[model samples]
Target: MDISFGETCGCKGYSVRSDILSEYGPSMANSCGGGNFVVFMTILEAFIRGRCDLSDPCNRVKPHSEPDYEYDFIVAGGGTAGAVVASRLSENPKWKVLLVEAGGDEPPAAAVPSMIASYWGDPAMDWNYRTEPESNACLGEPEQRCSWTRGKVLGGCSVTNGMMYMRGHKRDYDDWEKSGARGWAWKDVLPFFKVSEDNRQIGTLVSSEFHGSGGYLTTQQFPHQPAIAKDILNAAEEIGYGVTNDLNGDNFKGFTTAQTNNRNGSRMSTATAFLRPASGRSNLHVMLNSTATRVVIDPTTKVVFGLEFMYKGKKKVAKSSKEVILSAGALNSPQLLLLSGIGPKEDLTKLNIPVIHHLPGVGKNLHNHVASFVDFKLNKENATQSLNWATAMEYMLKRTGALSSTGLSQMTGVLNSKYAEPNGNHPDVQMFFSGYLAGCSRTGQLFEPLNTNNEDEKTTISIRPVYLHPKSRGYLTLASKDPTAPPLMYPNYLTEPEDIDVLVESIKMALKFGESKILSEKYGIEADKTPIPECASQGEWGTDAYWRCMVKVATGPENHQVGTCKMGSPQDSLAVVSNELRVFGIKGLRVIDASIMPIVPSGNTAAPTIMIAERGSAFIKNMWNWNKPPIVHDHFSSTDLKRNCGGVRTDTNDVKIDIQTQEREVVDWHKRHVHL
Candidate 1:
């Protein structure tokens, strides 16, 4: 019998072939009792309706059309940081802000926490990037290429990620200051984090000082979790690991239920938290389905003036009267700079593009957290897994059920490997739990049950042990001059043998949890005994050599890529932006996103990126003197201008003199100190 289903884009008003359904009715009934099939269809229909209602206009940011040719600020890429930066900068009611996003608004399915993996390879929602074939890693995958999934939607990867709201260790920020990112110490940037956070469990589940309250971004644990989650936490404690309620609070090293960026069982992306509140502002305009191609830089003056973009099959330019900020994410932001002739002179000349500034650090220092997947089997006869019609109904009516949470996947564990400092503040390894096998089918169906012939194998679960601080660095270069083309990525996963050592240690540590008395007695947990076929020749199955081989074969390069456009002092040769986030040799331009991170944080990157946006926005406001008393034109002299413009004041009496000149002088000062 032939059966056909509708598109999963919005799942609204979609139809199935009636004749095919009728033809296959009896066979489907025989395969899985008639009542069961009917119940499945009923739940499917209800899910479609709920998704459509959640994606309605009232829950999304309304796209703006016919934006003016110029604005006070033009923010490129309305992702995690871009959305927050644009929203905060537009608060003064006097500045006109334009935000350009390459993708459309998020779909209804993105709101469902359990459906996060459904968007992994979907071209409509993900960038679908793959690392250049690696010889040392990803041997099990086709052609040894690791899939790097970045979001193409408005909310960016936050719409496609696990939604874990991790802020990394405080020492991570102090290290940033020591690495030339001055003023980025833990104490200096904590307030910006609080300004964007609205933790629901501030006093009860988290510390009031470490967490925030009464802010836009709502964060809390999912309302529902599987029964197995408690057992997993108990197992961690039994294995001599500290268990805490809050990973983001005082204790960074521990095992606990994850705090997610969720609100009432739905995802609260940066677009939902920041953009939705500022949607009604006349000063803020969001341009969806628009791709920013290049930064328009004045050739002789080396000052950014506007942005070139593609919208509706036509090329257009938007002028920035004040600044053109690039928050296009780590991958795209550096690619845009290379396309705009702001990269190394030798490489630009090879591509026959005239060099604008010859900044050598445009696309260097790339890295990400990498992990290895380890599988285990649980006794399903004793476990209480509730992912059926009754739970589906419960979620549809009251938003409380297994479907409202990620189950055991909502738990995380952080511990220090032998390579890490023994201090609890610096955990080098992290663990992620997946309650079920997560993958997308060829037909795009999501969250399907694992198929296995063995009854015991049907209850398989996975734990991913991630190496948080990797020394294996990679870089990306432009594939061609076309803006629509993807950059050539060289993630170089596991290139360093030290990285493999860390993964092997992490894998050993995770197996201890499976062997703990609590998990063994309560859940009947056992590690999959099958040895990796590719690693069989390395050593004994449980030996360190065998685990090292397994790491190379099943490499998991996480989505937390950062440090391509690292921020540092003017004296640092590889610094793309200064401590203030301004491009060293250019005027009216700054990069405020994950790309500026000198070192990737110890955990997830979304929360820190938002903090960077908040801090960077404040820098822009202070530099422009927003809300400060307007400089009295009659008394505005060179001395006042010098103090405001970093001592680059012009001697002209005209108060309306082009501020661009002063900006150029400031850039020149930094350029002299920057190693060419």
Candidate 2:
């Protein structure tokens, strides 16, 4: 074997003998387990070490060694939206921004797309929140409680999510506008979404009208995908569904390959995209491994002045001269608000905490996109393993392999169920395809044994039918007065009979793809016959009653939780924040994350949450008169500047503009900057 080795074998200061390389390389590629494979992996580790030696310090956000006691802005929670808000707010040299995150930075494993499952129950990465017991849902889970895994790292859930960049149907935001959250219509929020995205496939794969280029966050499809992904797309087409190139474009209801928040086959979390870019700014200071216990508000003025946090096991306070933004996400944001005495008076009194503001809707209206998984068995065996020496070598050398992509898990279908309007753009059901059945026993082994007769590996896939719009609402409250204690989360999944009906219809629709000629004939896909022991007595195997019983037993709550600190008009009693995201009865305080969502969007919440951060940052800048030059027009009349801009007073110019006029101007400004 004529194996050629140059001066070095990719690794610096390391030379490989042709004879040794020739012998081991071929053997490593042929089998996963062998002395040759072990030797090759040892050599690969040296190569990885050499590559790590060449890493640039500028790529990472170093923790601020010494943070000032006071800053112009104090952002609580350095998660998804919090990172964006801190970065955008620190753009001005005059303002100092402090970002406090409870968790540390994202680990090395988080960069790999296939390693997403590794973070679910990990205490270092996930908050590991579980919902309170529900009668109708989570029947199969231990104690009938569903596990809610939220990211605790700097990037928050973005660091631990599937990375699908879905903006949802335009009607989803329009519905928010109709329901008291004025100026949140699709047209108003679309510019922010475009500005935040730096899509790698603008003119080629996606429409220029819907995507932007040269932005902070990079959005692109993974370089490689499994062969089954194409089959899934074909199956969707065979089942009378449109296969689209861009799911976020004109046709919202369709099946498409995933466009994710990735750059060069790695995850581009908000911390990586937004915060790291702003790390060089002297005005921005990031404090990691710190938990914000409470927002200190003046009882007399009902104004937030500073935040109380614990760092290095000692309580500390960071004063905010301008504003304090709560971007701690849905669960923690409201929990922090209640701890600061900004919730219902009755609840605060019961906890013996003095109420600074009697806000009745601090932790109300909690809900999420719930799903149910249906297992399918393939006649063939798994040709490739997700994690193996070959895949590891390919990814390490060329950044292309199974590790580069999420396989068929990235293929998604958006369709309306029988309950939704026929032939409408809005979709009620979103289908997720997985390459493996996610069922695991208490010992973390597969529930069913693999068929060992074939030479290849046995394969079992899952089709998840996500009910996008659930009518049932839930709430969250303080489990205890202790800041470290987890909140009592009552997701109340499938409490309403209508919610179960939607899931049933969605499940049937997903089963159609398995029955399609392309999937059934080519892949020999069949529904898994494993009986749900609790659901068998409901009806015959495939009946609606049996499926309904199975749906409740196999309830899957997606991580897209929202509406706890809902944004709404002040007239609405449940309104925690105004459209500008300012807390109702408080001054110099805002919530810029997913918690402020009035209603959950039709799809994933990550993209929408980033858009909210962009819009909220603009509101702060506009009110403080920082970024754009004030345009004074005598013809323009301000109806009520207080209500329009959340009662925030501007500079000496005293420039006052209505919410609609300001939003239009901001959108136009962003439009001019964008390529399209």
Candidate 3:
């Protein structure tokens, strides 16, 4: 009999297993095949060799041991999204789960609560990516190197991301249903969001009404807002935002206290909360240092059958008896699909890769959060300590105080305009507040050797206003046939005029908040540029032409890339998966991670990503339990949105919708397992 495990222990990433592992293959191999990203290297080399620079990080880890075993589900990429998916799925004792992370698990030096301000310069935990070039944003900065930092360990991006948790406005979900992710409306998905989280600050039922009680994930509003955090919200309120403590409640369009995924001052990454707890479960398996190279499909019908990956130094395959879920993330998921012959025929043909199925929507319709840096500094006393060694000691030992703070003071409010327009339900703009005044210079390699004397010069406080829901779209494509090559990605940011119009309004909204009276006295905040320079060039700064030119050039693209494998109507050219998240025209295969987002959510993707995992876990459980039953870990919900979406479609006479209305077939089995 055959069974699969999840990821192996440690941060070695994912690898395959053979019944004959002892019979063949060497111990510790570098099958990354020439080019790949390295965990640590020189700053310049890292930049020159990174994915954004050339679509491949070009380095591989040389293992110290032999290849290990396989798991039931080998989740590729153990970052923010991967952690929640692996954790929820592993709850069942009858099945094994595996999570493969590309980066090694050693904690980054700046990951400590005390050194939060130094993360940008710390290479141990960051994946810095600079654009080829930009037209408008960061000013007076040496070079534009936008930093794309994400934790490479089990917690993934959660460990590295700003810990602010902002629940989007209700209209955000309303928009999804309108866009084609029909059953996933706000009210429908809210429970999953609440169910997946366990807030450290709120009461269970009171919070559990929208939060989980016994759930592993924990969230706490910032321990101390710091002068900078408090003033930003105060300033926002002065500009007309209704100040409130909770943004997760009814109306999200206002200034509010910051909420975060920190428990007792330590980062509450999904891995720390979800994956780590179940690591010892015999039914769950985790593999580190393994890379899933391709999906094995039935060449005759184009039906997906299993997957192919490298373990240690040898190749191995794992067949899926029921379903194979892809949670490898946006770039990699679509790349894997296209590599296995599931993307556009033309694109596939160009790389000389065979077309197993003409999946036209495979790597198209990309979406990303776009942002810009705005700075105002009055003094240094209120700023976060530049290099405070004493404070660091206190935080590490007791897990108390400022060191534990996630760099963000709060999620700047969601705004429709500076003044309330009696117009739409959705807010037109949103802003993220930072304690560090990061200029637009692209972040250099985290692996760069830092001169010990230069530690005190880091700046203080940055307020970035992200242009939410721009009409612009991007794409992901393979640079080569090699699986080791990172997918070529283009966010195609601000390509459309309509996208630019929305962003223009967003910048003005941020300025209004900066003018608040309460915030100025506390944080020493100031709006350096009274009127945003109109020109893209220095000559146009005070002119309307400069504003227009700056609008075009002044944006830092959101690293939250999604919609590459967009989920929507099959008739649409850009729709890769249906609302059920199944690959278009494929059988027994699905793409769950960030790749299937029909539209990006209101704020950060981490919270919403966890909710998606909760829903997907139910979908898989429902599908798998049709035959075999889980003997442990009782799931309480009778009706899950994912399972509900999978069934029942609404139809109009002139047109057809893809809703599946079949009855949930888990009655008798439910009784057997939970004794209901």
Candidate 4:
């Protein structure tokens, strides 16, 4: 009898019998073609090289000592942005850094490329956050509360995120500049984005000027390109949508194979990319499984001095001599600020917590990328093993197969919705096409199985229509005085009529994919064969009301929440932080995370979040003379500024500034560091 344990454990390629291993030893390795060995060795070499760089004075990191108390820099929340911030800040050997993480390290299984889906809700990796019930969305879910999954591990959401390396539209940053966030236009920040990327898969297919080769993050195309990706590309082109060879390149519009932060079939999370090399630094202290309960600020002076955190079930305080940066994610960063008495005065007064500063923007402006799924059941014979024995053996023995892919959305298409302004350059809707049904996987907190009649268990194809820029803003509030208590997240998705109209139009546009000759004629499958039967009971299949009902019942977040602690000028009453990322009312305290985005970008939040950290790090370094100030470009000269109306969308909140104070501060800093 053929023997294989199952998909989960057996995929690593081992047999319970010793005799089997001995028989297949060298010969099996040869048959598998030594591909897996080469891949492993290449990664090991890169890691070693990164370690060597860490020992350099410009990038050195010293391990934390047990007796150490105070640090020059305290970076709270060792997540995607936090890891980058902490690692970069500790490069100066004289400045001791402390990185506090609420989660432990990424597990061994988290390394498996195909097993990426398994880490979403793995108690070992996820924070397991859930949002409060919404009146307009998540109608099919239990209690109408949607699952908001954030990575609790060292890598943060990068550990379990879809792993797409998208930089969003150039207009996004230009809009930030037009909205009062100077020195943040696409050209001003492009250098920093290039500085963080170390693209490994640069060949004839990539643009040399647009990509960087000597950065920390490793970005490349997935080893296994699903057959559906090619089919979809062809179909997309036939339908008149342009095909972009590289989505991260100059052309932001079009359908293409998604780029991921993976190296040699393994997920290259911020933990592995940024933290691993710096983990050995004596000056860099990383406290894992430690939750920062509050930022210790002098209530009277409104100055941050240290932090109180829970570690190993014991409460402890760590002092910061220079500065305390909050790199915690969107939810936790705002939540921590409130717990430390830095939120709205009214809310804090009601909670009986002394208000250090009445920053009304603490937990407000919470929003996310909302998506609705459109699935089509493919012919069973054509279905790939969503995860089966052969694919497992291929991955285990060869390290090159479907198992090596990102396992999330494989292809992305950027296009304008019907409701989009005519002749607009920016695409309002982004569609993700995947071979497997979106929520087919039984595990993971984000996967909510669709209520459908699929007793046949046939193969499925799904397209997720995501609204790029949402207008309906939400707020996160404290459930109680308890710091450990999860914040009550009210996403307030689809509250706006325009948002709902755009999404409904997006679904109609995605329906074209199913109707394409490549999917229906070539594949011999019917477009409406695998209908979301639940919606059929509501109304006729193709009606506006039917699709609207389908959208309401199936609408879910893409997990790209941002803009809670918006970055703006002090004059803006809702502004929580200055353009430098420093809190307006507090000294020695700053927030560097997705929460600081005034308006969510047009694409994935991960890449932009990393870019923010890179820029924020430079800002801090320049303040201490550790690095020279970056030469910023004139935002008015950009093509985006000339073609499109400057500033943010009419529906979005504009980033306003206190220009006189900002100018004065720049002059003062220049005088203090006149030697430069």
Give the winner by lDDT.
Answer: 2
Highest TM-score: which candidate?
Answer: 2
- 182-243 in candidate 3: lDDT tens per residue? 56778767756765555555552124345443355666665544545655555665666667
Query: How much is 361 displaced in model 3, in angstroms?
Result: 0.8
For model 2, residues 420-526, the per-residue Cα lDDT tens digits are: 87767678999998873121111212222333355365577888999888899999999888999999999888989989999998888878877888877778888
Evaluate model 3: give its TM-score.
0.75
Candidate 2 collision pairs: none
* Candidate 4 to truth, TM: 0.81
Better of 1 and 2 by lDDT: 2
Clashing residue pairs in candidate 4 are 61-281, 62-281, 62-282, 62-283, 63-281, 63-282
Error of 1 at 486 (Å): 0.7
Which sequence of candidate numbers ranks them by TM-score, best first?
Answer: 2, 1, 4, 3
How do all the candidates rank in terms of lDDT, highest first? 2, 1, 4, 3
- The per-model lDDT (C-alpha) reads 0.76, 0.76, 0.56, 0.71
lDDT of 4 by residue, 1-676 (tens): 2323211112113313212221110111111124433343233222212211111112222234242588899998988999989878987878999898888766434455655555565555677888889898888888988888899877799877878899888898888777666667786666667666656656656775666544667677777876667888888888877798887788888898888887555567777678765665678898877888999999888888998888877888999898999999899999999999989988888889888888998999899999987777665334433544345445544446666785537689898987776886888999986665221222212322222244345566678998898899999988888988998899999898888888888888888877777777666544443346667777787777887777777776887999899987777777898888899889999999999998889889999999899878878887777863322211111122112311111112112233354335334543443222
TM-score of each: 0.84, 0.85, 0.75, 0.81
Q: Over the full model, what C-alpha lDDT does candidate 3 score relative to the true structure?
A: 0.56
